[model samples]
Target: MYLFLVLSLHTLWVAVSIAMQHGHYDMCKTQTKSDEGIVWEYMACQPESRDMTPYLKVKLEPPNSTCGDPPEPFCAMGNPYMCNNECDASTKELAHPPELMFDSEGRNPSTFWQSVTWKNYPAPLQINVTLSWGKTIELTQNIAITFESGRPEKMILEKSLDYGLTWQPYQFYAADCLDAFRMEPKSVKDLTSSTVLDIICTEEYSTGYATHTKTISFEIKDRFAIFAGPRLHNMASLYSQLDTTKNLRDFFTVTDLRIRLLKPATGATFVDERNLERYFYAISDIKIHGRCKCNLHANSCTFTNNRLACDCEHNTTGQDCERCKKNYQGQAWSPGSYLTIPKGTANICVSSMPSNCYCYGHSNRCTYIEVVNTAVCVGCRHNTHGQQCEKCKKGFHRNGSAKLDDVNVCIANICDNELLRCQNGGVCHNNMRCLCPSGYTGILCEKQKCEDTGSCSSKSGQESVSHNLYLITMIIVTRLCTF
Candidate 1:
């Protein structure tokens, strides 16, 4: 089902192939000032001009290595040129390299199928993604990549403090890829037969990862086709379980966060359906988790226990004061949190009021009970509960949520009524299905079960051969007497 959804999207992408031809690095032009602190607009909103030189754009340095013949490295269209005539058809393959998948554009979700491919191994495929935020994100939480499949491969994550000029592996501690096996043990239970692996840095190893660099780099190692398994995972799982050490601002300060994907100088090659061996690596998505980037006004701004400890006003709260505290809600602005506005003396709670308890079909019958610090409506009318007399009670089933202006009343679960209702105080469910009492058995709880003979054993109990033989003999004798 998941594969079908992905393929369907791929087919729809062909119509917009024109916009995807340009590589991201060389695609957008600056419409206004290119200041470091300037707020960056979406690429589509940026002015389009073909005359902008490559040096004028803000782009990461391209990988020193790529596939194809030597003397001049080959890169996808709209990328930096290492030498003259870089993107000339005569010097490069006739087909353009696949575009790398990254940020989402308006109206469309992030394009997942776009990728960078090479007819031959591109040593290591390196992609540098820039990170931008209004207020600095104090914690570097986690990083995860979704690949084409869960295949046996290795990628070294690196970071660069001084932009992409230099890079080093994230070496706070040795990362044990095996830790991921715990989360999805079923996938890699038999490592020999495993095809996908979601590698997560265990809690013990994530301790000071962000202190090393600002740029995140992935160096994927090639695995043989005989043991190919493509894997994908969420980015949050890569962070340290301890929130204190996972703060991003504790490390170096950077204006741009770049992610570089480097394909090895040499790696595995596979024969395509065309019977051609091609060296290609692809990624579907990259996700980063961290606190919101909003400037907040609080009584104090400080880090407490690795969290942004802020004594927000009654109207505001959240990592960056980005949300209104419960009971105070309105449209967001400025600091981004919803507020009651005009000095914050209004009660605009998001939750429904805790008023008189009501159950479905009865407005004044149900009573409220405190359970686990919350009020619960019990003994509701029509076997329902809720502050608004909505929702079915326990042991009842609801097909779906009640529509607006609809009363959500639950019907009784009575066992077969026309036939024998459960005998001996048995419970009824599913209209006629009876839940028999102990010391009794049969469809309607009509038969007395002998405890000594284990006749009341659960249905899953192993039946003795003697019992089966006795039952058969009784049936045979009854049939002979009738004959």
Candidate 2:
């Protein structure tokens, strides 16, 4: 609900005339992109009321102009178009145009105002302006730029956090009209007189072209100035940033702002003479959101240069400091970050996943210990050991030392060195089992179970030996008996 006003440069010709006729620049349109990246342009947003008055300072002087009688009071040569002109019916007096780019009323009715000319200038004209808050402020995830000129050829934005000494390309929000078309708000006011319509219709303007019949059909299309892009006579364009690593608050604190106009609107030579050769450019407004002011007290957020920064605890990071940091993976939820969803809003939701420690082939297993910031891998597998289950365990040898990413490389010894194989011709299997011989069995086949003896000689010699033994045995027995 909080809106921070930045720059407002209502640049459209019709809006300029309306602002000139009226006292304020309320005729200009404004664009607002929600957190979901859906753009909403208030054709009658009248954001001049929210102009960033205090911080705006015109760094370069634009062409000068004066308001005089006879709206087209004939002026001789040498004195070119006055910036802004208005005549008083009562006193026949002409008033000076307002400083900054806001003074838009001009004498030429066909063209909005006599534009600053650069036809014969030595180089291309560039408009440079700076915005500052007098103190630093936290930035949001995106910056929205609105233009009034409707048809400026080119514009580039840059930012400097260190007071203009250095600058980097500030990313423009990427946009698409495809999905955004269905999400356009229906309750918006008509955009027939809108600056965006002017840009759309004028794209194809030519010298002899008469009227544009496409306006009627474009108006009936139920289009939104913000949600659809201006396709000559169609809808407003969509804008967003995809795959952008840097968010609006990534800068943390911004002290200065700058906008450079590389290409501007050149007078359409095809248009009536009143608008011929008059080149100009104008920006309607800018809006940016930042870190919540309440974060300083409740969330321990730090305050710098009138801005608040969330005091993100280690292993946690986000705008509200509610999400876990990378590696310390976890999905975090906090009421502080998002309070409630607004009605009628369309959002591309991203689902959250629970955080867990990750490990490869276990040098160690991951164990989630409460109160510890990082999970520890405890029981390593594959004979590996380390905080991340990466290194080899003490007694294990690593295979292919050259492969750094190989996780299952560690090898362990399965048997004692003395028993590398079964001893005494035993067969070893699985580094532990030893197959022994038929008559030998032991841990290493070292103990013998049976003894081997030899057999007798020839058959005849065996028979003679048998008879002699029998006689000798009988004689010995008889002698023992007699004794």
Candidate 3:
């Protein structure tokens, strides 16, 4: 009996030893350390341990690394090109290598499908960012970025519809591209078997990522569907993880802020010199990445300001509540936190509603939220009613002060309510659609003035959208009382 027991023990020991070996092999040794000993030895090396770091918040550095304080490779005075373009003593146009956000705030120790976003960075003459997550079948949702590219010509957006396999032309014009790539809310496609949405710009050079921006952007929805755009991401899985050293929320850099520059150069080939200068993204600035390893069922974690301190909680991740985490930040079991605005006061404060809420002031506030799905300042007050949240009470006019709260209650009919309407020559159409005669288009016709800016938003032939169709199309037409 003793000999039989000893044999059984030996067999059990062998099985346990083999199990530990296989377990270590299966463990993701990519970022973590490995050791050996007992059956439960491998279990001690959890991926979360390697995920440790002290990076949380950080300065939102400019998109291009050249924006550092001193400004690299200084030259003699009076040299505009050297001072601005990172050029050497002479005028040289070296690509403003972007700043990669590498730190603890970007590493992924636990969870999946996590992503980051930056909002404080204002638009410039030219701007671009590249990112990728998960494997071939991992990239799902779309991303969009709204920028002010200095020049009034248009925006340039380049993307990779495939897994960094091919390329498409860069897109110009934010209005047009945004109008096209604006994703349908909660769209569900066969991401696993068929084509997944790839409308985002992932600027990976190793995968032959030529400047596809040279080509004209493709038709909206179709461009991001299944097979177009610039292919930047080579491997799918490699795109999803984070760097344990940099801030997670700001993983990419903005190389081109060219508001001062003129028209985006139009060339024939896809190269740096031939690179298109302008852009708008399919998923402008707002990118949400998830994990491909786990069954698409959990929230991805994220780091704010270079700090990995924040958990996605079930199925939530990103500077905003983009992709959720497992159980806590991503899982349906938990509601998880909502997507947060990337940086400082983004003209959009969601929670602070009713009182200083801009929605109370602007009619387009809700629409603005929808376009970007972020917070917005309504700028409304007690004496305001119109969309711009600028006006006097029903009975009281501007009362000398046309400001939101700077008006007074009317004692009687101080003046004709009709004559002194929008003083700046804007058509005093009811509800303050505030169209400035003919050459105006803005929240309050604060731009220029004109006679008849065609009518749109109504579809009634002559109906215009307060053209020349740049940003806001708030215009109210009124009948001229000709005698």
Clashes of each: 31, 31, 109
RMSD of each: 27.3, 21.7, 30.7
Ranked candidates (TM-score, high to low): 2, 1, 3
Error of 1 at 428 (Å): 99
lDDT value, residue 275 of candidate 2: 32
For model 2, the superposed segments whose C-alpha errors exceed 4 Å read 1-122, 127-285, 289-315, 318-327, 330-419, 440-483
Task: Sort the predicted structures by lDDT, highest score first.
Answer: 2, 1, 3
The local lDDT score (0 to 100) that residue 457 gets in candidate 2 is: 36
- Give the poorly placed runs of model 1, Cα more than 4 Å off: 1-60, 63-100, 103-110, 113-135, 138-142, 149-154, 159-256, 264-277, 293-483
- Tens digits of per-residue lDDT for model 3 on 16-57? 455343221122112344475332211111111121112211
Candidate 1 lDDT, 1-483, residue by residue in tens: 999999999987763342232111111213355566554322211011121111111233353222222332233222223223222223433221223334332423223322233444324444543443323342332354444322112344444445445565431212233542233212122223133132323223221213232122221211111122233121121211111232322332222344444331122233232311222333444554433233223424444554433444335566555566653332232342112111111221132123343223444432223243333433456555565556655545453455422444454333445433566677777653678888766655555566447655564233433444554565466458645
The digit string of per-residue lDDT tens for model 2 on 124-164 reads: 65665555544344453244443434334434345676657
Indicate the TM-score of model 1.
0.25
Which of candidates 2 and 3 reaches a greater TM-score?
2
Number of the top candidate by TM-score?
2
Q: Rate residue 156 of model 1 by lDDT.
A: 42
